[model samples]
Target chain A: LAKTTQPISMDSYEGQEVNITCSHNNIATNDYITWYQQFPSQGPRFIIQGYKTKVTNEVASLFIPADRKSSTLSLPRVSLSDTAVYYCLVAKGSNYQLIWGAGTKLIIKP
Target chain B: SQTIHQWPATLVQPVGSPLSLECTVEGTSNPNLYWYRQAAGRGLQLLFYSVGIGQISSEVPQNLSASRPQDRQFILSSKKLLLSDSGFYLCAWSSRTEGPYNEQFFGPGTRLTVL
Candidate 1:
């Protein structure tokens, strides 16, 4: 199984860009990095997904280095509503199950 | 478009009581189903997943078990609830055919409170 590690929490100001990075040292060749955002008492919402390089969606962007050992989720001009627990995850192997980390609790301040 | 549904939005149960949580996906067939739990201020913990009907995989050993009686429905049940079982329960579905990424769609979630 591919385990991910991320910071427990972070703080950012409104209208500022935020980058939360995750480390998956033992990630397999087929593993894909993904991110999700969760608000209080709700299921996580998909933020972005990527295998290598970068993947950008309307909500956020995912940047993966060439080695694929780590990935960063970048939020541009974040707002207060973007404050949530952001999870970094990877698929294990042969289409492995999504393994989640402790997540980065992003706090967007005014 | 595809959507997933989980019932009884919120539930409260006493310790040692039986528990059942239902999740259904609409407008899709033969999806990869998953059951996840999140404690307060914590990340998601994958409990169970199903690739096909009657095929369930347990991730973490616990009092809870999962069943897939139909292609698009999954059930998470516990013969006897434990206080440790209390948390936010989420049901998700992904498409293997979509791609290698396997992006998942989640339901609204059920808040389980065991007293």
Candidate 2:
């Protein structure tokens, strides 16, 4: 399990792009970066995952640098409903243990 | 699509009372199941995980215990509840085929308040 650090909270307005960065300085070679979004009283939902470089889905994009020491979760055209807590995790390929941090609270203001 | 179900969306238990929370997954087999607890305004804490029937791993040493009676059914139990146990309990499942990188599907969650 790799420890991750992220912003405690962030603020953004509607129709804006929001980028949340996570730092995992001691990331392992077998580890991959994953991001999850959790709404109030709900389970965290998977946002995006990547090994290196970039990976994009309909919801968000994950940008990983060559060093893989950090990753960024980018959400485009955010809306008020995008307000949630974002978690970044680094874990080995087959490892079942997921290390969780306090996460970043993103508030999308109207 | 796979779906995870957790019962008793909300529960209020007294201290020293027995506790049982059930989680079941549908449309999937041999999936990895996980039990997590979230204190108010805090991150999720992993309590237990099961890879197969009759197999369970405890992450933190606590009064709570977990059991996997069937492939898709995972249960969390405690002989006596504590006020510390009051929190939001979540159940998650991920595909074994995709390993750890697989996206975890989470249940709506169970809100337990121990008094």
**Best candidate per DockQ, number?**
2
Write down the RMSD of all candidates, one decimal each: 1.4, 1.3
lDDT (10s digit) by residue, model 1, range B4-103: 9999899999999999999999999889999999887778899998889999889899999999999999999999999999999999999957543687
True contacts kept of each: 0.66, 0.84
Model 2 TM-score relative to the real fold: 0.96
The docking quality of candidate 2, as DockQ, is: 0.79
lDDT of each: 0.90, 0.91
Which interface RMSD values do the candidates have, in the order shown? Answer: 2.0, 1.3
Cα deviation at A69, candidate 1, in Å, is: 0.8
Clash pairs (backbone) in predicted model 1: none
RMSD of 2: 1.3
Worst 10 residues of 1 chain B by lDDT: B96-105
